[model samples]
Target: MDTQIGCAIKASNELVKNLHRDGFDRGCIATFNDYMTTFTKNKASLHRSLNGINNAKNGTRLYDSIVDVIQIFRNRGEVSRPWILVVVTDGDDNISSRSLHKCAQETSSLFTTKESNNFLFLVGVGDGVNSEKMNEMASAGNFIYIHAKDFFLLELIFLKIANKITTSLSLSLGNLTVGDHSASWAEVQRHRNLSKVAIDYALLIDVSASMNSRVISSNSVTNLNSVITHATRAIGQSFDSRIINTTNVALLASWIDKKRGNPYNFSDLPFEFKLIHRASRDGFGNDKFHNNCDNKGPTIVVIKVKYSGEIIGGYNPLEWRCVKINEWSTLLPNNHDFYIDQQRRTSKSFIFSLTNQTISRVTLNNDAIIWSRNKGPCFGLQDLCITNNFGKSEQRSYENRIINKKNFEIEEYEVFQVIDKRPRFSIFYFIFMIFMGIFKIIKFIFMRLFLGIYWTCYIVYWIIYWITYWTVITLICVAGIGLIVSILALPIILYLYLEAEIAWVILSALFIYAPILGLIGEYLVI
Candidate 1:
């Protein structure tokens, strides 16, 4: 939905011309066509108001353009049945002759300041756009802009808009229901008809109090999850969970909650760092693991390596550390912009290597992880370029010199997975999860087989304890399942029940937990 503003103007000109040739009333449409032609041809000298701004000869004359467009609405009304005017730039108000404050004040009048899906929709294109200013210019759904790249993407935006205005561009053969709406587009090509992709993801967002108060859009459910999963998969990473394979990835999720002026903090981060209570639950640490992260409790087990290091991650610049989980893991404020030089910072964290101090785009799927959405994680004025060298390092682990923050020195750590016989996080990730899973199995099996008051009750209680552990169990888990056995105090409890030969207690435990413990133990084996 993004294209350069000028490109949009060009698109409008073409569409109107076609409509005029198609025998549609050319009076009001003609007015827009003429204004656009003048703006494009004599752009240097054109003092325009078609874009709702005055003297928009340079970039700043939107006031006049807006006035001109609004005039057409007044004369004809109904805006010729659904036209669009998208502002495709960061509203820096740099090239404008009018001050932003003045433009903002006047622009609010261009469209009815209500959310009734009336008037023109204002879409701020690039990070430079003053969203507030854009909001003032917009009436409702009509005012939206797509951030432009080279002219290619702009052209796509125009085509998409044309399709939207004319007919339904996207159609679902699947069991989707776009009920009681429009039919289909006349000229629409049924290309990009995706039947299936390798990966499918479902993000069960935790909309709890401890988490962000933002809600994922019902409209975007199917597409958003698919897009996000695909985006992650394209980087050879996994989704449906949080795992940072490499810091090189340009990470982004729905930052809409932040855009809606919602709360942001790490306490609300949907995922936790602790290893799962069950062995196999290691972030799906199976061969299917797309990304890599140490399941070890959030510890600063930094490794200094003499070779290439891959495991790299930084707090998302948009995310903040929540309350301290430990000496190592602390809560990050949902808002990192406070310490940032620019309010519109892109990426959750400022990465190194761009001359412009912007978070460098993470290259994946043979395409750089460029952003199309603009919200909490959108780029800022200072973040347009990469901060420093990108791709200088590869993987983090032993077999290669890794810089352990704890030691502040490059050293070796166990290679969980093997890449060139070097300990890379991706491989390490699978190994760690598998190892933990196996350990859990052995523990559960032994606990059930040996500790005999109740095979199910004792094991079930132990597994739940492992899952609910709020304190220091990660370091303990890796050591072995033996520790879990000791920590839960199962043998002692089992002995008490058995010694008492308490018929009521035995029946109570069975009614409550025999099946549960059996399941937990079997789960480990599975």
Candidate 2:
């Protein structure tokens, strides 16, 4: 015991030295067995006190010591510095006047304060220590519990605690080698390569000027405008980018999803493009445009200026719904005009010019898209508005004007709905999927049946096991009671009758065979 006490004191002194070296210059050391003695933060004084603890104490008052340490910290008043309390015990509490519950309450109250950073570590040493009780106390106090097999391991444990405290107090670069740094850079490059933007784009070419020209074909001179119109019609088979295979829908999807913070990788899925409304097909009526493209998710409107040959368009993330006159009136009570344009707010809206290859994002998030009953899809207050096939472009809510021309007649205008493409499956693949699903169902049923059988057998085994165990215990308890009765009666029988050899023999038999029977019963139960 004395040697054990000396080892504990030596380990504690080493811990204090290590803590002081690790920049924890000010700390309190409290030693407790039956009673506790605290030493303030002086290196020499702490060492002297630790060396003076030569004798070993008999009782362990663990709970009482914890309360005392908490009280000492509280008496220090308010402190900005971090507080760390380390409690080491070799045995369970034997002389603690303070209940475990009371000590836990004090510990919790002391540690869970916003005043300063507080840390508590409870360490149990040797096989005699009650680890479960220590764990419970640590959990209640919101501290850490550590167990050491012997007193010799305390040095390593204390050193680790000092290192932990130092690490928490300071910040430093991690253990990354040059190779690791290079590997990290390579990973970043790989991520950048994989994270390319997905896009859905349309090319609107101007062929209006070709109307006045003539083209010399292999047979004869033909009208160039007619040939051009025929080519445009052939290209306008469907707005489906996959069918066209000219524009990169993946790039557009990636860009949009990234900007909107959507985790979905649109590049993995093909885009379904449908030309909802074309001015040539549906006439240049605003009502017709809204009726066809109103509830459609996202649409791209592209216009080819008549003479300038400038191709400009805007991306509306929201559906274009015409605001009712009554709703518009309520929205803008000050406005007297019969025509009221509904301003839609969105940060994702953007306009671009194919000719200039410039994209302008909406500067003012609010009023990004405007919807009017009289005008076809309007963007940013006349930034770009189409009414009866005539379009106007003026920079207002957007960063830059996509088209220089303020007002121009659209040679051709098309609105295409941007949607995720549905996967096409072959008949064979569909049949395979059906078979796989059936197999999965069969597997699930078999697994459930197996589990049911296993649990049933397991329950039966435990039932039999408990029954045998109780029978053995009952026999051992009866034998113990009989042995006690026989011993108590033998003393009286021996004093009362001098020639009680039969009773002596019975007593000897009971003492010898009772233990043998109990052992046999224990073996059977086990």
Best by lDDT: 2
Cα displacement (Å) at residue 396, model 2 = 59
Q: Residue 483 of candidate 1: its Cα lDDT?
A: 42
Per-model TM against the reference: 0.26, 0.34
Cα distance off (Å), candidate 1, residue 196: 34
Candidate 2 has an lDDT of 0.60
lDDT per residue as tens, model 2, 347-431: 9988876444457889988889987878888889788899987998899999999877788988666787978565568798899
Off by over 4 Å in 2: 21-24, 33-39, 173-436, 439-526
Error of 1 at 509 (Å): 59
TM-score of 2: 0.34
The list of candidate 1 runs beyond 4 A from truth reads 1-12, 21-59, 63-76, 86-92, 95-160, 169-252, 256-433, 445-526
